[model samples]
Target: MGTIWTPKLNSYSGAKYLRLAQAAADAINQKELLANTKLPPQRRLADALGVTVGTVTRAYAVLEQRGYVYAKVGAGTFVRAEESEFKNKQINFATCQPPLTNQISVLSDAMSQLAKSPQRLTQLMAYHGEPLKEHQLIFSQWLHKRGITQQPEQIVFTHGAQQGIFAVLNGLMQAGDTLLCEGNCYPGIHTAAVQLGINIEPITLSDEGLDLSELEQKIIAHQPKVLYITPNNQNPTCIQYNLSQRQAILALTKKYNLVILEDDVNYCLSSEWHSPIWSIEQGSEQSEDPGHVIYLSSLSKVFCGGLRQGFLLVPNLYALKIKQAIHSQCWMISPLNTELACRVIQNPEFMGQREQVIAQRQQLCIEMGQRLGLKQRWRGLNGWLQLALPLKAHHVVTALAQKNILVRNGDDFNNHQNFIRLSIGDAADDKIFVQQLAIIEACIKSLSQTAYSVV
Candidate 1:
């Protein structure tokens, strides 16, 4: 450990220094500082900071209560190490990635088969320029399973859904143009929008979907060029829109002439598919122009992140613009990754593997809900748990980090609600999954008790 974090008392905006202490602990929690480190003793820290031991003691207590640090009978309290912090070991529910065992096994088999055919191996090395026609056809056929149909000409291959998002937004909107989305939308969208100098306005959310009243208000207020939506099993909240909700949003968008950027990247993992805004617009023959929706999706979540293969279903009207954007970026996704994706999607056994994966995720969700005494709020690979936290989410996240359990706090997604996203991608087995949840539960109970005692 370099040294116990000592906040510069005069610099912090608050007099209490509690937030400063919390910020120090959060830095440690996020691995900005090394883990398994030692914090200064209360008396020693007080002396250095020119503060009383009581203030330092209170701060330390808060840290301990929040699971950022722990005391021993003889040894000094220490910043928790990530790897060996918790008794049960670490569970990685932070990142959204599918369990790799089955994918690896399947890929290995596929690769071995591919290696045998010299002609195919040579084809993978050749560069098929922008809008790889054969690959587009293959993707269109695969996407048909999810009720998405498009001409090969309409598809643009991207490195991943993230890149596709950036490309489409960059192509459609100019600098300073406003983009509308759910208040707590995917971080990736926020990141892309910011990079392109596009302003984002958040619409209120409800159980059904975006609050139409608030959405229309924002639409009128912002005059946004595009609306990004994760209609099926939305990120962070895992809330899906029903038919009425979809129609309401479509109606508003149509009224405003706003382009709908539908990001259904995780649609493949969903148990049941909800009709996308693209489909709604496509089926509406009464509209003079039905090309209002831009669909973006990928196999990263369902297939393999390493493949980094995403496809875009651009509206026929915007095809040229999106293709220009795609060409400006990378010209094309690697032919190799596309081939891998094509092979995986074509494999008959892959569906069974997907079913098995979904089963595992559902089982974990059910168990977590039962243990926490909440209805399981999971769809596809990710689940959301709204925590009744005694402390702020930062403290809770830090506490969990100390325990070797990684989870995304709702605040990370611009969601002020006390929620944590539990992705089934990292928990490889059921026993470990349950054990991890038990740790989280205990931590919550412990924090709640501390809060009570303090009161």
Candidate 2:
């Protein structure tokens, strides 16, 4: 065992790195890794794997993509304490590997074109100027496709959607106003709200997306100014708002005069993805007042999350305020990321890759449904399969950890002790994930009908 290298996993299969990352994440969850653990350098890990540095870079990228790891500029990657503990469950699901498919070339060509064109370079080089009208036009296609009638001019660029949140929050609310959110919302928003000293009132939810009645009641009772919602493929919970619900929510927003912050992050992932609430045509009975909805999205999901490129579609009336806020806090990203995203969206095969992933997700969902039924299942973009094991979810999660398949625990989504959200959705090795999830399901089934909180 002296001066020896062990082949832990194959990076080509992608699932191996995902499994390794998950195993490391699980250990961190149990306080085994401790706070601020300096992970093995990427080069050493790759050397141990007998693989290239690029392979290790990719694996770390996967971990970073799913918010499990953080990179310090000039320093090595380290486990994010809060994120690690949050993902502290056993999942057969692999990390989301952002495959550099052919569409990347499409982005390369755009960069090439941008480099060649002195006009684009001159106009887009600074933080103060507006993005190219062409960039605005391409973003408009994304908007129209998503059922938004917004002019490209209405769309403003940001470093990323996270910045967009800061911008919107800065512009829209004072320190004390409440921002109503879905009960099981994205963690980023939760952190942001807390940081700003803004109170968050979580509306209850289910398969039908938000509880409109409950939300309306909360709106009346609390009088929250801003309403945050992930209407399509809702985070953590795959719950989506149906057409009727959108209509009802719009009515309520107008009634309560709420400034809706619609985080339509996962909008493009679904083939049958419905038009967002803002995209719907407003009429005399339903003329949505201007500045009612501020839409947010990023190329992270469809293009490159590393691009850190986000776009905001704001109502014309409030666009100036949001834009000024963006300028004040998270100033313009390098035009480079925008060039990368604009390039990716233009690729004809870009949508094809999305479709392929969609097919993969459908198969995975079916496969997961068979292996693990609807008892505790919740499906979304990130393979958010919630197990029906109730109190046993924790036990099932811990048992799966022994085998080294990583998944997210459900309590992170909601305080429901019985539910476990299995991450089976995003960029994972489906074949291996299916097999491993089956094993986890078997492990859970074998455990005595007892629920013990592992923490």
| Cα-based lDDT for every prediction | 0.74, 0.66
Question: Could you give candidate 2's per-residue lDDT for residues 1-455 as a string of tens digits?
Answer: 11122334543232344445555555555766656666777777677777677556655675665555688887877767664543434444433323333334445557777789888677676664567778889889966775667888888888878888888887888798899998877778978888788998998887787887789889988898889988876777667889888778877887878888888776334564777777753333447456577878887655556678888888877888887787777465566677667777776545434445545655655665566454433333455544553436667667677787765676766657456555444334333345665676567655634464342
The prediction achieving the highest lDDT against the true structure is: 1
Clashes of each: 1, 15
Q: Write the per-residue lDDT of candidate 1 for residues 7-99, one digit (tens) a residue.
A: 655554333435446566666756765665677777887888788886676666656644567777567767766554344656787888776
Tell me how far the alpha carbon of residue 254 in candidate 1 is from the true structure, in angstroms, after superposition: 2.1
Ten-residue stretch with the least lDDT total in model 2: 1-10
Per-candidate TM-scores read 0.76, 0.72
Mark the regions of model 1 whose C-alpha exceeds 4 Å error after superposition.
Answer: 1-89, 267-270, 374-376, 389-391, 452-455
lDDT of 1 at 224: 90
Task: Give me the displacement of residue 452 in model 2, in angstroms.
Answer: 7.7
Superposition TM-score, candidate 2 onto the true structure:
0.72
Model 1, position 377: C-alpha lDDT score: 76
